[model samples]
Structure formats: structure tokens, C-alpha cells
Target: METVRTVCTICPSACGVLVRRQKADIVGIEGDPESPMSKGFLFPKGLSAIEYMRHKDRILYPMKRKGERGKGGWERISWEEALETVTERMGKAKALCGPQSVIMLRGAAKGLPDILLSRLGNAFGSPNITSMGFLCFVPRVYAYNATFGCFLYPDYDYPPATLVLWGVNPSETFPPLFRRILKAKEKGTKLIVVDPRRTESAQIADLWIRPRPSSDILLCLSVIHEVIRRGLYDASFVERWTLGFDRLERHVEGFQPQVTEPYTGVSPEEITAFLGFYTQGPSAIQEGNGIEQSLYTFQMQRALYVLEAITGNIGRPGGKTRWGNPKLVERYGPLFTLQDLIPREVRERRIGAERLAPFAHYALPQAIVQAILDGSGPKVAFIMGGNLLLSWPDSKRTLEALGRLEFICVSDLFLTPTVMMADIVLPAATFLEFDSIHMPPDFTYFAHVQQKVCQVGEARSDVWIVNELAKKLGLKEYFFKDEYELYDEVLKEEGITFEEFRRIGFLLGRKEYRFYEREGFRTKSGKVELWSPDLESYGLDPLPKADPSSLQSDPSYPLLLTSYKPYPFRHSNFRQLDSTRMLHPYPLVLIDGKTAASLGVKDGEWILVETRKGAARAKAKVDDVKERVVVMEHGWWLPEDGTFLDHNINVLTSADPPFARETGTPLLRGVPCRIRRL
Candidate 1:
């Protein structure tokens, strides 16, 4: 038996893992004790990596649909035939309706595949490459870039005096960060958790501030007001390295804690105490997906950045700090994605680009669906590593839109619901079966080598498939001959081959605090923009503000519905694995005991959750949730039963208008809904 050091790609944590193998069979998977980031911490999902790679239902070869879309019948086909069919369909669509007639869709941003997909779209002169980013972390990315010109990552090395987990339960979503927070807590660092539900993190927090769902912006503004009123803000930093502080102070005048208490569901006294803890010393606020899925995603994130700045948390030890990528490595950006290949006119034609300036070249999923149904969207779609039927909102519409497509191709490890609708399906290798470079997403300044311990039956890496597809589409000059050549080119500046990088295992970038001191923040005025001129230039609000009236209780749909990702899965993955599925036997709708009693719902009883859009059923889990709020699990699909929509929370979600203007982020959270025992 031999053990191979690699990074787990099941989720974005990219935790270091050791895959023990006997010849070609994977024996066990565990956390790498030598990892600098995780430090021997491994979640259940990482531990089940072997089960996922060796699943019986995995698609081992390329296939062509034998009958109508959504039919299970398929015929095994050669890679050459699969490529030819895909190239023919895509090229035909391009010839008849211009290159913009083909759309590329990806799910999670798992390292190189995202870049490769974007590159393929640009090289093909299409500007409609879409991903889950609109509803995920893209809003935060936009807010950070527009406000402070960079991402603010927590400095785990320098434990914060106080850590504020705002709308984030790192305990489930990010175990590595949660472990660090626990260690910091042991060392006398105060912990404050801001979430509507009583999460594991909240239960252990030094202080738990439960605000109303979608009222986080108002809560943040009130906190800022309290901090300013109490003179707890950093006067020195504000005067030296911030812009529009006076406007921000004036803007918060009407949003006092007393005024916002009713709307935010947080008391003035609690807000004061929250401010007291945060302003105690060097602090870090970790924002999560909770705020990113709201109607006010951009404004809410902007408010958080303003809060961090006013508290003097930015660019300090044990506080939020801007980071740079590792030296001599290929950075994932416009240059790497070959953004220049697509002309300005093609980019202008991107769906929803006219309204969302920050959307840039990517298309919104809802807009893409609408365009397809209206005969204006791409006729051919090439989806990589995504299950739109389960992940995207408005499932009925998504299904209809996909049916309207002239041709669809999917690349995945298994035959997912989305794959069921594909004209062709390409087998994709799991992280353990592929050799590639893995980088942690969003502020983790590190890159590592993912070693291929074994290969499954004819499965190929996304990089290999993309390069081969590019070659078939007559774009060979822009792509490498093989995956290794691409890797070598990416590592050229580092003066190391892919083999050498594998031996090195990982490369961590130097973490520099107060980077703005050498050069001011990367904004128009070269300082943190409390009120952004760039936003004004983009025809958006220059300052962040939350409308309390938007939170008024809806009489028609009295209860609020929200969703959370369970610990055992990563957005529609791992449900097929018996080991993981046994841990979470049923999709749960977590409701407060009082609410469940009122709805005549008992524990473990299946209940119908109805929203303005539609309804879905999930098992009732009476828990410590807010009285009028119900939290359902997102990404629910039963592969064993072959029922994808019955339990999917997206069926109860809307992709309608009133989206966040900046990022086109749909309201995936805090939607008005009601429930009934099934």
C-alpha cells in the first residue's frame, strides 16, 4: 500500500488529504497532518472521497442519447465520436446564429475547469458563459472590489481578539476555518455569531445575535450608527485611508438602532453589545452565503465592508486583510481566461449585461432560461460539473428551458438529472483520478498539486476534454496539445515542472498586512470608499442603504422560507453514496417547534413548503429556528429513487425579477412562504 498526498476538491475548502491505495484500488482517505491550512482536519465529505470515486453508478465512458431527452436510454460511444458530435452541433449553431448562439454553463468553481470553460467561450467568441457565481460569492467579490478594491480574508495565523461570524456557520460549511475559530476562542478570543438560526457555531458563541432574515443590511447599518455614535470607530484610519466617511455618517443617521429594531428583529441593547465586542480590538468578520442570496446582496456586502473599515479591522493583524496571489503562478483572471478574444460587441450581447454592470461577460441563469424560452438564447449548451435542475431556482422553468434547447452536452462523474437531458454525456474523472493544480477559492492565498493516484475506466479530466474540444473546433492554436503541456506552461514562471510541483505539494503566498500602506487601496481615490464613485459611474447607489419597508411581513405568505446546505453534501453531490446518504436520510425542513405545532407538523413528518412560485415536500425537523421562519435543505435529489424534483427546495424558489441590480443575484433566501403537513 502507498499513500498519496493531494487536495480534496469535493468542496471549495480544498483541504489537504492523503489517499491510501493498494495498486489501483483506493483503500482509505484521510486528512494530511502536514497540511499548513487544515492541520489534520477532514470533514465527512472528504472522508467519503473513495466511495464517490468508486461508485457503481459512475459514467465510465462517453454516451449518446438513444431516445428523447430525459430518457435513461443511452448508447456507449468513443471519445472521437462524442467530440465530433459536440463540435458539429456547436459549430452549426455558431454558423447559423453567430458564435454567441452557444452558451457554456459550469456549476462550482473547482479550479482549472472554470478558467478553461471561460477560455473556451472567449476563444469561441461567445459571451454567455454562466456559473453559480451570481447566487454565490460573486456579489461579495463585486462589493469588495468596488468598495476596498480587494477581498478581506481572515488572518487565522494572528488570532483575532474578537471574531464575528456574520451569517456564516463555518462549523458546517468551512470546518478548517471553524477549527481555527475554536482555537482562537480557547486563547481568549471572544466569538460572536450573527445568524437567524441557532447553528452549532451560534450555540457555542460568546454572543449570538439573531436578526430577521434579509434584514442584515439594516442590522449592519444600525451597528455602524451605534459604533459612530459611541465614538468607537477608528478616527485615525478613517481620516487617513477612507473616503466618504462624512456621507456614511450622515446616511446612517436615520438607521439608528432604535429605529431599526422592529425591522431587524434585533434590539438596540443587543446592537450596542455587539458593537462593544467588535470594537474591543483587532477583529475579523467572516461573511457567508447567507447574505449573498438576498435581494440586497450588493448593498448588504457593501455595508459589511464599511463596517470593517470603520472598525479599523482592514489590513491589521488578527483582522481582515487584503492578500496577493502566489508569485510566479498563473493567476485566474481576465488574461488567463483570454477575455480579450471576445469582441466588445459580443460582450455587449451578454444576457442581463445591459442592466447588471458587474455581471460583465457572464449571463444570469434566469435570464438564460428566459432567453431560451423566448427564442433569443443559445441553442447549444455545453455544461460542465453542474446540475441546473437541482441548483438553479425555478426548477419547472429550468426544465422547460432545457427542453427547448436544440442540443445539450454534459460532462460529469455520474448520470445526474441534468445529465438525463443531455444529447451527449462525457465521463469526467474525480479529483482522485486526475492530476491538476488546486487552488482554494476566495482569499485563501495558496496553490497545491492534486496527484492522480488512479484512473477510472475511460474517464477524463475537464482540462483534457476542454483542450480536445478546442482542438476539434479549429481553436487549436489557442490551446495546448495536452493537459500536461498546459500545466507546464502555467508553471513556467515558477521554474518548475508539473512533477516538481507534485513533489513540493503546496505553495503558500506571503501574507502581508497593511498592504495599503505601501500603496493605497485599489479604488478610484486609492482609499476605502464608504461611498463609492465607481458605483455612481455604473449608475448604482453611491452609498449603501437598506429599506426597512422591504421587510414588512407578507400577509399572503406569512412565514419566511430560507435554505441551508447540509454537512454531508456539496450542492447536489454525494446523495448517491450510501455512506453519505445514510447520514442524512431525508431532506429536512427545519422549523421552530411553535411554528411546526401551528402547522400541525410533527417531527420527521413530511410537509409541503409552498412559496409564491411553487411547492416542494421535505421532512419536518422541529428545531430552534425563528418562530415564523422555516429553513429547508438546498440541493435535494434522490438518485436511488430517481425522483429529482419532489424534494428540491429550488422548486419552491423564484427566479423572477427584483434581483440585486449590481450582481443580478436572485432572492434565494428570505422568500415569503407557508407550510402544511403532507
Candidate 2:
């Protein structure tokens, strides 16, 4: 037996891992003790990596649809035949409807697959490459970039004396970060959690601030108002490293705690207490993706940045900090450069480009569906590593739009609902079966060299598949001979090598603080822009606002429905794995015991969760959630039982309107809904 250092790709956390193999077969998996990041700890998902890779449901070979779309029948086909068929169909579609008619979408798979998909679209002269970024971290990244000139990451090395976790459950979604938080807590660090539901992290928090769903903007603004009103802000730092402070002060005057109390469900005293605790030196706020799925996402994130800046936590040792040394992997170096390969005319033809501005570079899933329904969307689509029907909101409409597509190709490890709608399916290698690079989920500091431990059946790495496709499409310049060649090209400027990276397992430089002191913020003003002139130029608000009145709840659907990822699953993945499934056997709707009792719903009983868009069935799980809030499990599907049509939360989510104006992000949280016993 031999042990190889790698990284877990089970979820976005991408923790360092050690894979044990016996003559080409994976024998065991564990956390890497040598790595400083995770420090010999692994989540249950990481420990079950070997079993997940060797699961019986894995698609081992390429297959072609033998019957109509949505039919379960398929015929095994060689990679060559599959590639030729896909290339021919794509070429035909492009020839008839221009390059803009072919769209490339990436799913949950990280690293090479996502980049290659974007590169393929660019090289093929299509500008409609898109992914889950619209629903994930892009809004926060964009907000930070616009406000501070660079994205600031929470500094966990020297954790803050007070850390505020807003709308994020690091304990479940991010194990490494959770471990760091736990260590900091052991050392007397005060924890403040903000979420509608009582997450595991919130259970032990020094203070749990439960706000109304989608009302985080009001809460953040109220805190900012209190800090300013109490003069708890850092006057020295504000005078030196910030711009438009006076404008921000005046802008937040209307968001005082009393004014926001009804909307945010936090009293003035609580807001003042929060400010008093957070204003103490060495404080940090770790924003999560949950807020990005809410209404006014971009504005909400900008308000959080403003809060950090006013408190002098911008460059503090235990606060939000700039990125460490550059990552070893060039996540989008080629794709960034290749994006221009698509001509200006084709680029302008991108769906939703006219309205979404900065986010126009990628196709909007909602807009893609609308376009398809109107016969103006891309005629052909290539999807990799995701379940479109399950992940995208308005499931029924998305499915129908996909059905209308002229051709659909999916590359994944299993036949999902989206794959069932595809004309061709390509087998993809799991993380353990590929040699690549990985970084932690948010605020990434280090890059880990993912070593291939075993190869499963005929599954191939995404890089290999893309390379072959590039060759078939006559895009020789974008094709790499092998993973070695790709890695060499990526590390050419850094002078590092794949061999060195593999041996070392990780590449991270010493942490640097007070980056703004030297170079200042990377904004147009060369300082932290409390009020952004760039936003004004784009016809958006220069200062963020908390307009709780913007969202009017429907009396028919009184309760606010939200969603959360199960601790044992990564979105829709791992539901078929017995070990993982045993941890969370079914989808659940978490409600307060009082609310459950009022609705006559008992724990473990099946309940119907209905929204304006659709409805789904889930087992009721009584929790300490707010009376008006209901937390629904995200990404639910039962492949083994062949009942893929039920239990997914997106079925009840709408993709229609009320998106973050700047980012085109749909409101995945705070939707009006009602629940009844099923």
C-alpha cells in the first residue's frame, strides 16, 4: 500500500487529504497531518471519499441516448463516437445560428472542469459560458472588489477576539474554517451568529441574532448606524484609508436601529449591544454565501464591507485581510485570456448582457430558460458536473426549456435529471482519479496539489476530455498535450513545477497584513470607497440601503422559506451513497416547535412546502427556528429509489425577477411560502 497527498473535492472547502491505495485501487482516505490548513482533520465527506468514488451508481463509460429525450434508455458508446457526435452537432448549431447559439455551462465540479468549459465556449466563438457563480460567491467578490479594490478574506490564522458569522454555518459547510473557529473559541474568542435558523455554530454562540429572512441588509445597516451613532468607529483609520465617510454617515442616518427594528426583528438595545461587542479591537465578520442568495445581494455585501471598514477591521491581523501569496493553480488564467477569442459581435449577443452589465459575460440560467422558451436562446448546450434541473430554480420551466434545446451534452459521474434530458453523456473522473490543483472554498490562502490515487473504469479527467474536444473542434492552440503540459504552462511565470507542487502538497506564502498601508485599496479612488462613484456611474446606488419595505409578503404564503445544505451532502451529490445518506436519509423542513404545533405538524411527519412557483414534500424537523421562518433542505433527490421528481427545494423556488441588479443573482432565500401536513 502507498499513501498519496491530495485534497478533498467532496465540497467547496477542498480540505487537504491523504489517499491510501493498493496497486491502483483506493484502500483508504484520511486528512493530511502534514498540512497546516486542516491539520489532520477530515469531515465525514472527506472520510467517505473512497466509498463515494467506488459507488455503484457511477457512470463508467460514454453513452448515447437510444430513444427520445427524457427517456431512460441509452446505448454504450466509445469516447471517439461520443466526441464526434457532440462536435458535429455543436458545429451544425453554430453554422445555422452563429457561435452565440452554443452555450457551455459548468456545474459543481471545481478547478479544471469549470475553467475548461469556459475556455471551450470562448475558443468555439460562443460567449455564453456560465456557472453557479450567479447563485454563489460572485456577488460578494464583486462587492468587495468594487468597495476595496481587492477581495478581503477573513484572517483565521490569528482569529479575531470577536467573530461574527452572518448567514453561514462554517461547522457544516466548511470544516477547516469551523475547526479554526472552534480553536479560537477555546481561546476566549467571542462568537456572534446571525441566521434565521439555529445552526450548530449558533447553538454555542455568545450571541445569536436572528433576523427576518432577506432582512440582513437592514440588520447590517442598523449595526453600522449604531456604531457611528455611538462613536465606536476608528476615526484614525477612517481619516487615513477611507473615502466618502461623510456620505456614508449621512446615508445610514435613516437605518437607525429603531427604524430597522420591525424589518430586521432586532431591538435597538440588541443592535447597540452587537455594536459594543464588535467595536472592540480585533474583530472580524465572515460573510457567507447565504446572503448572496437573498434579495439585494450586492448591496447587502457592500454594506458588510462598509461595516468592516468603519470598525477599523479592514487590515487588522485578526480581521478581513487581502489574499496571501498567489495560488499555484491558474484557475482561470487561460480562460480569462481566451474569453476575448469570442468576437465582439458574438460577445454582445450573450443572453442578458444588456441588463446585467458586469455579470453579462456569462449567461443567466433564468434568462437562458426564457430565451429558450421564446426560441431565441442557445440551440445547443454542454453541461459539466451539475444537475441543472435540481440546482436551477423554477425546475419545471428549466426542464421544459432544456427539452426545447436542439442538442444537450452532459459530462458527469452519474445520470441525473439533467443528464436524463441530454442526448449524450460523458463519464467524468472523481477527484481521487485526477491530478490537479485545489483551493479552499472562501478566502482561499493556499493551493493543494491533488494527486491521482486510482482510475475508475473508463472515466477520464475533465482536462483530458476538454483537450480532446478542443482538438476535435480544431482549437489546437487551446489544447494541452497532457496534465503536465497544462501545469507547466500555468506555473511558467511563477517558476514552480508540477513535480515540486506534488512533492510539497501545498504552496502558500507568509501572511501579510495592512496591505492598504502600502498600495492602498484597489478602487478608482485608491482608498476604501464607503460610497462608490463607480456604482453611480453604472446607474446604481453609490451607498447601500436597507429598504425592508421593498419585499411585501403574500398573506396567502405567510411564512418565509429559506434553504440550507445538509451537513452530509454537497448540494445534490452523495444522496446515493449509503454512508452519507444514512447520515441524512431524507429532505427536511425545519420549523420552530411552536409553529409546528400551531400547524398541527409533528416531527418526522411528511409535510407539503408550497411557494408561489411550486411545491415539494419534506419530513418535518422541529428546531429553534423563528416562528415565521421555515428552513428547507437544499439539493434533495433519491437516485436509487428512482424518484428524482420529488423533495428538491428548487421546485418551490422562483427564477422570475427581483434579482440583485448588479449581479443578476436570484433570491434563493426569503421567498414567501406556506406549509401543511402531507
TM-score of each: 0.98, 0.97
lDDT of 2 by residue, 350-461 (tens): 8877657553467888888899999975899988877988898888889899999999998998888888998999999988888886654453566678888887989988
lDDT score for candidate 1 against the true structure = 0.88
lDDT of 1 at 313: 92
State each model's C-alpha RMSD to the native: 1.3, 1.5
Off by over 4 Å in 1: 328-330
Q: C-alpha displacement of 565 in model 2, angstroms?
A: 0.5
Task: Tell me the number of clashing residue pairs for each predicted model.
Answer: 0, 1
User: Candidate 2 — worst ten consecutive residues by lDDT sum?
Assistant: 327-336
Q: What is the lDDT of residue 651 in candidate 1?
A: 92
lDDT of 2: 0.83
lDDT of 1 by residue, 311-384 (tens): 89999999988766665445556678898888877788788786577534478789999999999867999999
